[model samples]
Target chain A: MRVSLRQAFAYKLDFIFTLILGLLVSLVMIFVWYAVYANSGVSSIGGLSLNAMYVYFFMVNALSFITYNAAVAQTMQEDVQTGAVSTAMARPIGYNTNLFLNSLSVAIVGGLTVTLPMLLIAIVLSHTAVSPAALGLLLIEVLLSFAITTCIGYVIGTLSIYFVNIWGIINLTGFVYYFLGGSLAPLSLFPKWLANILMLLPSQLMMYTPAATLLGIIPMDEIIREIAVGAVWLAALVLFTLLWLRRISRRVVAVGG
Target chain B: MGLKREIKFFITCQRYNWLSFLAYRMQAFVWLSLNALFILYGILTVTIIYGVSSGISGWSYYQMLFLIGTTGITVNAVWYLCNPNGLVRQLRSGKLDSTFLRPYSRLNIMLSASGNVDNSTTAISSLIMMAYAASKIGVDAAGMLLYAALMAAGISAFVLFVMALSVLAYLLIRGANFVNGVLNFMSSSSKYPLSIFGFAGQLIFTLLLPIGIASYYPAEFVLGRLSLSSAALVFVLALLVGAASYVLFHKFMKGYVGGGG
Candidate 1:
């Protein structure tokens, strides 16, 4: 698995391009919000200072690189649609395990190559405060968030057995995450009722919680609780995915023989 | 005869899409609902921002909503109607060879070749939203008509610009998804007022990417910040850029040694 991951990273150009893209977008977001802050003149929307908002968005940008799993979902959907999953079923490994590992590998490598550098750059350039305790909490939250997000993606991908085109679903998921996850603006900007509702959705865990943790808006205990919620979501999604695969596997009549 | 044939081809494409969608109409509904959610998010974000402030750059919340709605309709229409057929796959398989061999002009064939009828729902929904927003803005009939004309021109300009860029991508890298990524980025960012990013960002959108025309410029005109002459100038610029891209793309295609099937 590691070898395959290394091979994936062997494409230096892809890694570089992805990194450059991430950085460019992060810079764009930073400049954008800078203007917003300038216009507003008062920092601390929902307990976030100007610097803190920058850090939050910067982290959102970096964490975005970490949680990138759409390609895996896409490949899985294609496999199911094209009967390529049958080939995987024929292999000795459990199909789900194979997928989980492949996704993890890609996520890890892509995260490190693109996201880690951006995070480091952001830390250096910005006036982001990162206490030792907060850093530890943020790291744990990010890991849990990634797991939950990947599982959600897996379920979405598995739904391809029934739906011919999941691209719209994927795009919709991405759009929601971008908005509701505090990517576009802080969750504090949302109406109180909307914010409360969004908290229950797993999309919030994807980018918001980690950003909040890093910004020190979320307390340590609350961060732990959020992680627990993320875990529950992940476990539920995994179980659901397994049941779905079992049902779909039985219905799979190998086509295009 | 040519126009009739083109219309028939377009209708046939739409019919095929309809039949395919019928097989999984439930899925289509689900996808459309998801798309609605996205649009709703855009509406909510703009509403919230506008609720806080008067306007981003002399345009009110309702006017910006109309801008977003129109941009969404036109961009989705272009993607569904043109992209899949013309740039992505044709470049990959060098099936553009057949396009060149066809009796029609290459530009016409390329622009009208493929359609994504599934996305028509999205386009229509966006137009409906645009109409709703326009109603809220309460423009005079003349202003509304002018807005409509500029929006039509804007959509054409955007489509032409995207097609041109896609053509450039074909020449540069046969099957690169880079242009699609950039387009996605543009669509995502354009949901907000261009003024959000400051003068530099606005200029980049206006000059380099032409995203302002997709939504911002027309909205500016509608808000009475931009004079009719400026709006006309923007429309003319869009046309000029589109023409240049078509010419440049054809010139590049001239050097093509067709690929194997």
Candidate 2:
């Protein structure tokens, strides 16, 4: 955490540019959706008012791109490529623990600079009152989403060690999030068959369900159900990562020995 | 005579670029899949938008697909040529100096000699897609001819536009990584009507970015919704942007004091 924060702050200009760009992209989405509303001549499409749509896009960008630690996969790929995984695994703190923490650290730092401001702007623009209880639930979901995504990242990263290259896979995952995850448009607006399949998958957890839950697009009962499902995903992913890591590390050791 | 030689040299080296793709057929598949997905993703976004509503003003679903298919050709070609990602790697590794050592003029080397041919697959696929969209709309021969002309014009302008931005990105190292991210956004946004952005937004995209010329203006003109005033202005601005980017790209080359290797 300390190292990541230090590295981020060391590139002060890069850090600032990233914040500005994040805000700019979110602002552009706001403009684009507002145009959709005006030109479509609909007060609401997908049952989201213009303001609610604004909040949705804003929250989706914040959660899916910024708060999401994509670099975990990149860093893991690097560690494997550079043979740093050997050194990383030797640490007493352990590799999986270290990877998970670094992922959270990157997210927390980004959440501080980009997500917080975008959340405030969305709240102000949408005028949706944020109750403390809802805020707490949102926090839990965000943490859970981070874990599942980080596991997904590690899985891809681990796969990189196997495939020797997975830029295509990484980008394919990003595309899934961009489309099925609701970064481009709300899953609600998608064709019923598509949206239903997406809901059955974990893609909705990527952006739609959490943001929709807080914004009241999903009902209270559904929100609770989504949270429970998210927890299951995290547990399953964690177990998979552990078993996968143990298997890979043994092979790595065998190869080296 | 000198310019003719450089052009000839560029086309020759460009053959080598394509040969290199054939050399590594697997890498080509990766890029082919990525670009194909990219084009389809743009088409899907339009479908989703229209599914929800009539979609962007004065543009039907097929018409939007036509614009998007054109962008698959234009934007992906720009990426193929001065790919923001490859440019970053070239600049970072100081491999740009390799271009300097070559016989051809620096401009030709930078634009033609350096690009990957992976997007050629995209060009072929997008042409088929564009034809499908055109058949849906019954775009006439004249409209197709004019659209081709507009695409040629837009491609030239956007090529320079991206080359200039890539240099600017190198100047801003922290922000440099996102040159392509911004380019991707520009690519994706071009699929919809530019008029949706309003007059001011239209001006920004046309004069400053020139992406409107890329796919939007051609699509709009064929659909008979293009504003002559804006379109005329954009054509003029695109020429100026193309000229300025030529100078700026060369100017910014001085910033490379190699050791990024």
Candidate 3:
């Protein structure tokens, strides 16, 4: 964790830049959604009060800034492509563990320093409440979201071992995750049939569940169901990651050292 | 004679790019599939928004689709026409110095090198979608021609803007990060209806950023809400911006000290 903090500080510019990107997106969403509600002359739609909708996107923005794991996939892909993986593989610490640790540090440091501040500003600007109980649950969900996303990123990065360029697949999967996961818009706004299907998917637990919980949108009974489902998703990802690492180890070769 | 020679050179480079892309068929397929998937996802978002409300700010559901399609066309057209990614990579690697040494203009070399058949495919896909949307709205042939011309101008402006942004590579080695970040913001925000952003947002997008000219104004022109003169004014504005940015990029190139030659 300490080493990860140091690394994060070393790449402070990237952290700041990413934070700015998230801020811009959040601001744009605020303007767009506010107009949608105001122009349509509706006080509420799809169970989201105008105020609640603003809060939802604000929370979504902050959560997304932290939970996004494309950096993990990119880093691992580069390591393998550039043959830097061999150096890390030969070290006392396992490569997956190192990748996991580094990613965790990035998330923690970025979430704390950049995203959290944005979240605060968003909460203040949007005039949203922060429920103590929901905040507690959101914390756990964030950890699980990070783990699941990182695992998926690891799998995407592992593809670089076989293909010279896996950016296509990486980007494709990232888009699917974001669009289906409610990062683009609230899953609740989706058609009922589509929303029902999306709810069953684990992607919702990553972004929607956390934001919805934080906003007090989900009921207590459903919140427990979400956490249980997230647990199962995390466990499955962990098991897949372990098997993936073993396969990578067997086929790994040093390329351009 | 020089123009003919440049055309020949550009075609040769494009051919090589296409061949190289074909060499990695699987990767190319994945990229194309993903690009199409993203387009579909964008359509889904618009559909969901309209489903919840009657329409955004009096624009119909189909109009929004046309707007999205217009954005896709402009974004993908500029992307395929001149990727700018190649220039960024070359500039970083100092291979840009090689292009500079050639008799051809740097812009020509940069554009020639960045041609991608894959992005062209996506651009064509956007065009087909836009045509479908336009047809649903009962656009005439003349209107279609006008939209095409406006789109061409919009794409030119967008490419120039991207080039101007990349000029920072000459000053800061890691400048592409900032450029990419801003571009991502513009591209993401522009995919939705412009009116949904209110006055301040609309003003910034219309005047300062001018991303709306590429997609929004063109949609408005097709929908008959925007006058022909107004639409032409957008095209003229885009031309002016493109010209100014070209001059700025040339000035910035003078400050570039090669990374490696």
Contacts from the true interface found in each model, as a fraction, amount to 0.17, 0.33, 0.50
Please write out the lDDT profile of model 2 over residues A1-257, one tens digit for every residue. 77778977864765566566565666666676677677789899889888888888778877774435577787777677677788888899978788878877888777876777888888887789888878887888777777777878887777756654566667777776667777777888888888778776666777888788779887878778777887887898889987887787665531221
Q: Write the per-residue lDDT of candidate 2 for residues B1-261, one digit (tens) a residue.
A: 988988788778788888766554543567668757666676777777788886766667898788878878887778777776577667677776767787776666778754757667777677778899989988889877877877777888789878777777777672455666666667656666667677987887777767887777877877777665766665676677788888888788777576363
Instruction: Please give the ranking of all candidate structures by DockQ, highest first, separated by commas.
Output: 3, 1, 2
Native interface contact recovery, model 1? 0.17
RMSD for each of the candidates: 3.2, 3.3, 2.6
List the candidates' TM-scores in order: 0.88, 0.89, 0.92
Residue pairs with backbone overlap in model 3:
none
Using DockQ as the measure, which candidate wins? 3
Which interface RMSD values do the candidates have, in the order shown? 3.7, 2.8, 2.3
The TM-score of predicted model 2 comes to 0.89
Candidate lDDT (C-alpha), each: 0.70, 0.74, 0.76
Candidate ordering by TM-score (highest first): 3, 2, 1
Which 10 consecutive positions of candidate 1 chain B have the poorest summed lDDT?
B50-59
Q: Which scores better on TM-score, 1 or 2? A: 2
Q: Highest lDDT: give the candidate number.
A: 3
Q: Model 1, A1-257: lDDT tens per residue?
A: 58656776553443454456555565555664555556666564556776776777777888876664665677677787777888987899977778778877777776776667767776777766678987787777677777766776777777677675677777666776777777766776677898778877777777888788777787777777777777788788878877876776676654433
Error of 1 at B113 (Å): 4.2
